[model samples]
Target: MPIQVGDKIPDVTVMTMTAEGPKPVKTSELFAGKKVALFSVPGAFTPTCSAKHLPGFVEKASDIRGKGVDEIVCIAVNDAFVMGAWGKSANAEGKVTMIGDGNGDLTKALGLEMDGSGFGLGMRGQRFSMIVDDGKVTHLNVEAPGAFEVSSAEYMLNQL
Candidate 1:
């Protein structure tokens, strides 16, 4: 089933890029005892993702945290190296936690996969954002195809 507003976040393991190298992070532990703002994008450094999606989160990271969030996570299907480089390029190395879902297991588990072969992009994640409180999803904002509706940091800030 697709993750719902009240569902307990699934606990899965993934190797996220860190300063030293790939580091293990469990999904449940990521949101444990905190308000987490987690967002996913199609790919790293994609047009929309670079210009608006991630930058919005970086720009509003402080305010989002001020609104009671403890962590801001930006996840993608790319590997740790690419994710790390993208985070640096996006100027979000410290502001957001970039988790690499190299195999798309995490994105698929979340029911947010988007096929982009026609665009020659291969497997990708749908653009979306969630406000998870203490491991339970409290808010979900999934964007329509070619649209950026419920996934912007500003929009979530208003909801908070």
Candidate 2:
């Protein structure tokens, strides 16, 4: 079954760019005692992801924080190097936490993995966003395959 609202997100290890290098972030720790907005993209620099999905959160980082979100997390089925470079390239430093699910464990646990080999990208994540409070999902916005409207930061902001 797919991960549903109220499901306590399983604790998983994700690599995120840190001052020294890629640091491991435990999933439960991410939402352990905070309200977070998490969004996933197919890859680091893909078209819609770059042009719309990520920028939405970047532009609304302040608003999201005002709404009580402690962290805005971005996940991609990419390595830490790519995620770090993408974050820097996208000017995401300090505004968001870019997480790398290089092994696809978290995506598999959530049942949101996608195969993009035809697009020349290997296995990737389905685009989606969710509000996690105290480690449980309170609100979720799952984008339709190939759709991007509902998962934007503006829409998620309205929910908060």
Runs of candidate 1 with Cα error greater than 4 angstroms are none
Model 1, span 1-160: residue lDDT tens: 6788998888888668876999988887888999999999999989999999999999999999999899999999899888889899989977998999888888888888999898998988999999999999999999998888789999999989
Q: Where does model 2 exceed 4 Å of error?
A: none
lDDT, each prediction = 0.90, 0.91
Mark the 10 consecutive residues where model 2 has the least summed lDDT: 1-10
Candidate 1 contains a number of clashing pairs equal to 0
Candidate 2's clash total is 0
Model 2 agreement with the true structure over 92-151: per-residue lDDT tens digits: 899989999999889888888999999998888899999999999998888889999878
What's the number of clashes in each of the models?
A: 0, 0
Clashing pairs in 1: none
